[model samples]
Target: MTLSNLNGVPGREDAVREYVQQQLGGLVDDLRVDALGNLIAFRAGRDAPNGKVKERVMLSAHMDEIGFLVRYIDERGFLRLQPLGGFDPRNLFARNVTVQTRGGTLPGVLTPGGRPIHISNPEDRSKVPELRAFFVDLGLDAAAVRQQVRVGDMVTLDQQARRMGDLVVGKALDDRASVFMQLEVLRQLTGPPRHDLYAVFSTQEEVGLRGAVTAAYSVQPTIGIGLDVTLAVDTPGVEADEAVTRMGEGIGIKVYDSSMISTRWLVDEFVDLAEQAGVAYQLEVLSQGGTDGAAIQGSRSGVPTLTLSLPTRYIHSVTEAVHVSDLEAGVALLLAYLK
Candidate 1:
């Protein structure tokens, strides 16, 4: 929940990184932040044959969330934004937001630049606004706004994560939940892993997997595992077939997505491991979207990769939810594999 609440957009992940670093202290043998702000932590493998080389396994979960940068501030103290990642405009209506400026954070309201429904024409009310039509109201005079806010300051939606029945709902869970799972796996390790682990808390994944691309190149892992959230559209409106994975059923072992197909052997291995360990698991095939796994898989000559996905609902929106049982299953499966 703390990971989800921390504000970190594509190129700005300092707060999230700092928090993760603090949690990871003494858990791993080595830790460093890369040039692109990806936090890499290394833990060596247990005893192996003197001449044998242990495989390097990279586990990546991004820290950044979809947000906006202050693009243009108008004379009336209204601020225009440039979105850093994918955002459904419908979710942007009258949202509480925070503008992180050089001096400090400012509270603001994010709304479209248009008339309210009471006075809007039927045609106007029927139309959905584009991202360009949105603006932030800082409730400050132009001079005061200009004195604090800048063109490139970060702006993030505000939402505190909370437990709802069997699910945890909040903003930024698309990948933060996975980040939390990775940290738990680290904490639960009873001994050195079977393979050398390079846990990467990546940045800029919401934009284009930018941080993972460079980190993968640097680490050059022999095997890669991406920890991310997958769509769980098992709501009332969506078809059963379209529900990529259902909440509380299990963690997803990715089989296919638009970015990259899971390495066949790795997928089979995890499946077998899950079955042997009696961990609930499901096969996922998403029609669209990608994760850091794609970047690591295609890194050099191509290392084998598979993603472990937590089924999530309402991704890219403030009310993103993940089942607690599913999170437990994911951690258990990863621990079983690493052991």
Candidate 2:
């Protein structure tokens, strides 16, 4: 929940990195931040066979969420934005947002510049506004706004994580939930893993797999595992077949997505491990979307890679939700594989 609440957008991940670093104290043998702001932590293998080199395993979860930057501030104090990642315009209506400037954060309201429904024509009401039509209102005079805010300051949606029945609902859970799972796996380690682990809290994943691309090149892991959230569109309006994975059913073992297919052998291995350990898991095939696994798998001569996905609903929106049992199952499966 803390991880989800921290604000970090593409190319701006300091707050999230700092929090993760604090949580990792003494849990890892070595830790460092890369040039691209990816937080890399290493734990040496303890159970490697005598006279045999240990395999390097890379586990990555991104810290950045989809957000916007202050692109143009008008004379009247209305701030225009440049979006950083994919956003559904329908969800951007009248949202509470925070503008992080050099001095401090400012509260604001995000809405498209248009007439309200009461004053709007039928045609205007029927049309959804484009992303560029949106602006932030700070409720301050132009002079006051320009004195504080800048063109490149970060702007993020506001939402606090909360428990809803068996689910955890909050903003930025697309990957933060996976980040939490990775942290839990580290805390649960009683001894060194079977393989050398390189846990990477990556950045700029919402824009592209930018951080993972460089980190994978540096680590050059023999095996790669991406921690991310997958779609769980099991709502009333969606078809059953379109539901990639169902909430509370289990964690997802990725089989296919547009970015990269899971390495066949690695997928089989994880499935076998899950079955042996009695950990609930679902095989996922998403028609679109990608994760850090694609970047790692495509690095160098291509290391084998698979992504462990948490079932999530309403991804890319503030209400992104993940099932608690699914998160536990992910941690369990990871421990079984690494131990």
lDDT string, candidate 2, 1-339, tens digits: 898999988998889999999999999999999999999999998766789878999999999999999999998999999999999999999999999999989999999988998899999999999999999999999999999999999999999999999999998998999999999999997789999999999999999999999999999999999999999999999889999999998989999999989999999999999999999999999999999999999999999999999999999999999999999999999999988
Q: Against the hidden true structure, what lDDT does model 2 obtain? A: 0.96
Those runs of model 1 whose alpha carbons end farther than 4 Å from true positions after fitting are 49-53
List CA RMSD, all candidates: 1.1, 1.0
Against the true structure, what is each candidate's TM-score?
Answer: 0.98, 0.99
lDDT of 2 at 317: 93
Kindly give the number of clashing pairs for every candidate.
0, 0
- After the best TM-score superposition of candidate 2, give how far the Cα of residue 106 lies from its true spot, in angstroms: 0.2
Query: Across residues 1-339, which tens digit of lDDT does each residue of candidate 1 receive?
Result: 888899999999999999999999889999999999999999999876789778999999999999999999998989999999999999999999999999999999999998999899999999999999999998999999999999999999999999999999999998999999999999998789999999999999999999999999999999999999999999998889999999999999999999989999999999999999999999999999999999999999999999999999999999999999999999999999887
